[model samples]
Every structure is written in structure tokens, then in C-alpha cells.
Target: MMNDVDPQILARYAPRPGRHALLPSLTPQQQVALLCRVLHREGYNDHIAGHITLRQEDGTYLANPWELTWAEVKGSDILRLDAQGKIIEGEWNITPAINLHIDVHSARHDVSVVIHNHSEWGSVWSAVGRVPPIYDQTSALVDTDPVCYDEYRGTVEDSELGRAAADALGEHKWALLANHGVLVVANGIRQAHLRAITLEWRCRMAWRVNLLGGGVPLPAAVAQATGQRTDASGFPFLWEAMARDEIRRDPSVLE
Candidate 1:
């Protein structure tokens, strides 16, 4: 499967044909530009608390520079880090969760995008350490069993803790960092963002249901049947497009 690539030591996986390419290869700046749009759109910039990362074809990862508000972030502000969490480019430092992202990406090569955020509903759900399955088409996120829950112990400060959280992911595309926030891992930025959005919505729905005298959880067989669900194109095109439009129209989200 790893063919048609450069002869360099890290050039094992070939870029898919027909996919867009960056002539000079994407710099950390361009990656940050797209990430600013994502962060601004996702409303995860609350006090500068969330991050998004893209694994480049060169085996390095690009992410937002530490300590910058999502809105204030420019394309030139992204930081590129290697597998060992060493910075290769950019001036800002990496966030504590940076190692967590590196760990997950190292363990799951299929996951090219990683997003961590302390979203509203996600934070609420994480505090309790529970995330129920789908109750609607949007909940189809859990359809493929993409959501995982990790109990809160302490802050994720070291590579070991990050690796442990990655293990909790267990092949799922998303996971709730208990008493903390949410993490989304997918093959593309759109897919990862979609998962994060849907996860927040699901958690909100569950929170509401719980408030109104509690709600019944889905049956095991029903959840399993739901998990069998899949998109014909392996993606939810309409939903993704619509969400992007809304985000673009109102980019000053957290402002």
C-alpha cells in the first residue's frame, strides 16, 4: 500500500491520486490559516483553550501556536512539531495536550487530523463521564462507534498520560476527555470538525434529556444496529457543507 512515494526515509505512504497538492509543500502558515477558520468556526476559542492539528505528508504535524486566541491567529502563526514533540517551525510553544495529539497520531496512522477542545456541552458531559449513543441522524456520529469516554484523573501533562488517553480512543474517531473536554481524530479536517460538532450537539441533547426528569438510554441491539449505519460516500456531504457555510458567514464567533 505504501508505494509511488519519494525514496526518503519518511516517504512511506504515497499521497492519494487526484488529491490537491501544494507545490512547495504547505508551510506552517497555510496550515494555520485553515486552522484559524476551523477554530473560529467551532467556537472553541474560549480564552484560547482549544486546538486543531493536521498531519502533513512529510510526517510532521501542523497546529496553532500556543497562547493565541483563535480569532487573533493568522496563517503565519502555526507551529510544526515532529513525532517527539520537538518544534520544527514557528515561534510559539506547544500546548500541554500537544503530546497527547502526537501520541494518538503515532498510534493511529489512519487518523490524520486531531482536535481537542473544551466545548460547552462537551465539558458538561465530560464532567460526569458519560456520553450516550445516537438519538437522531446527527447522532449517527456514534453510528460507527466513533465516540469514546475517558474518565478524569488529572491534567494530561506527560507523554504517558497522552498515550493512555489515546489507548482509550480504541479505534474510535472521537473521545470525551472526562472532566476535561473532547478529542476528535479523523482522516480529514472536515471529518474531524464534523465529529466535534456532532459530539457537542449530542452531549447537549443528552444534557437536556437528563434535566427533564432523565431519559431512557437506547437499547443495546438498537445501538448496535445504529453503529452499522454508514454514509454512501463515506461522508455526510450536505451536513458538512452547511456547517461550514454557517461558520464562514459569522467568523467572529467567540468575540
Candidate 2:
């Protein structure tokens, strides 16, 4: 239920393509670093697990190296790898689970960022093999139903299993890998991070609601309208605010 004035104001304040002349271009490594920092701050890290990958124009990608926990990752610690998961740069080895991102990026030309995490509530929902119900407006951020990969084929180190998970993801922006965790794909690192955070929040909300007999879902039309309204501008503002906060906390992430 945003007023007309709100949309205009949001658009006015939204990050423009070349507005920040003093700030350097957001590089791939910085994208990975920002994603990892924000995700770690939000408690998305499961020890040294979890990863964020950003596709490069050359079909390669920059990813968080396996050696560093999300919280410990700096821009310089991010690794560059070809589409086949071969390390092209950086000192640390890539995560075996990176195969999942490779297959997903190969299959989905539109997606530029992929995030995988064993986040607490997200994994809980995955274990039950259920998508978060449309309980809150934040649930509308997902827009479509999250697909579930029912088969858990161990660690997803193999490319074939990764392809299967990508097939399960298909056109959806989010996928719940049953008994494993969640994966979120988006056109940019910021959006992917936002989706991952929002999806986890929705899962937590659904869990709490289920404990209280579960609330009814919003009508499809209403949900769709709300999604359209928010998708246009809400996420960009949220992403900017998060990036600002993360920069304030640790400016070294840019290095």
C-alpha cells in the first residue's frame, strides 16, 4: 500500500548508474565481499560453509574462497574461476559445492549472482520440504513459489547433482534443497543477498505461524499486486541501506 509519493521519493534516492563519481566502480570481488559481509552479519554463515558467486562478463565468476569463513572474507580473498570451476586466480581452493553455482549459472543466462547457505530457519524449512507460506508482506518479495529439490544427494560436489538442483530451480529465483538448505539466484549480488535474507525471514515467520495453527495466505491477486509494487523500488533502497551499514562497520571489505 505505498502512496504515489513514496515511489517517487524512492526513485529519487535510488542509486543511479553513475551518481557516485567519487566511489570506484563496484568490482566483482567487492560484490562477493559485500555479500559475504552482510550475510555473515545476518548470521547466514554455517562455520566455513556457504558461498556467494557473481558471474563475470566472460562467463567466469568471482566467489568467496573456501578457506575463509564468510565473516573473515575480504575483497582480496575472493577467488576467480572459470565456468567449469577451475580456479583462475586467488590463492585458496574453491569450494566443492561451487559446482552447484556453475550449473545454475550455465542454465540460467539471466542470473548473475547465486547464493547458497545453510541458514538456520531456511534449513529447518528445507528439512520439512515446505515453502514459506505467504504470511507477511516480506513473503511477497519471493514473488513465486520456491521449488524444492526433494533428493538430497550428499554434498553436491558432483556436477550432475548440481545440474539436477539447477533443474529443480528452473526459472524460480529461490530453491529449497531438501535436507540441505536454500539457494537464491538474482540478476545482481545485491538482489540475491536481499532475496536470501528475505527468504530466511519468511521461513522463520512461517515456522512461528505454524506453531500457532498457521495463518491464511493472501489472495493471489493481492499478493501479486503487492509484489509488483515492491519489486520496482523497495529492494534497491534496502540493498543500499545494507551496503552503507556494512561499509560503516568494516570499510576494509572494499579492499
lDDT on C-alpha atoms for all candidate structures: 0.65, 0.79
Give per-residue lDDT, candidate 2, residue 68: 84
Provide the clash count, candidate 1.
1
Candidate 1 lDDT tens digits, 134-225: 55556554455544556566666666777788889878878878878888787765456556666776777777877787766666667556
Scored by TM-score, the top model is 2
* Cα lDDT tens digits for candidate 2, 14-122: 5578675323466669868887888877758788887888888888889998888888788898999987889999999887889999888889998988988898788
Q: What's the true lDDT of residue 231 in model 1? A: 24
Q: Cα lDDT for residue 155, model 1? A: 63
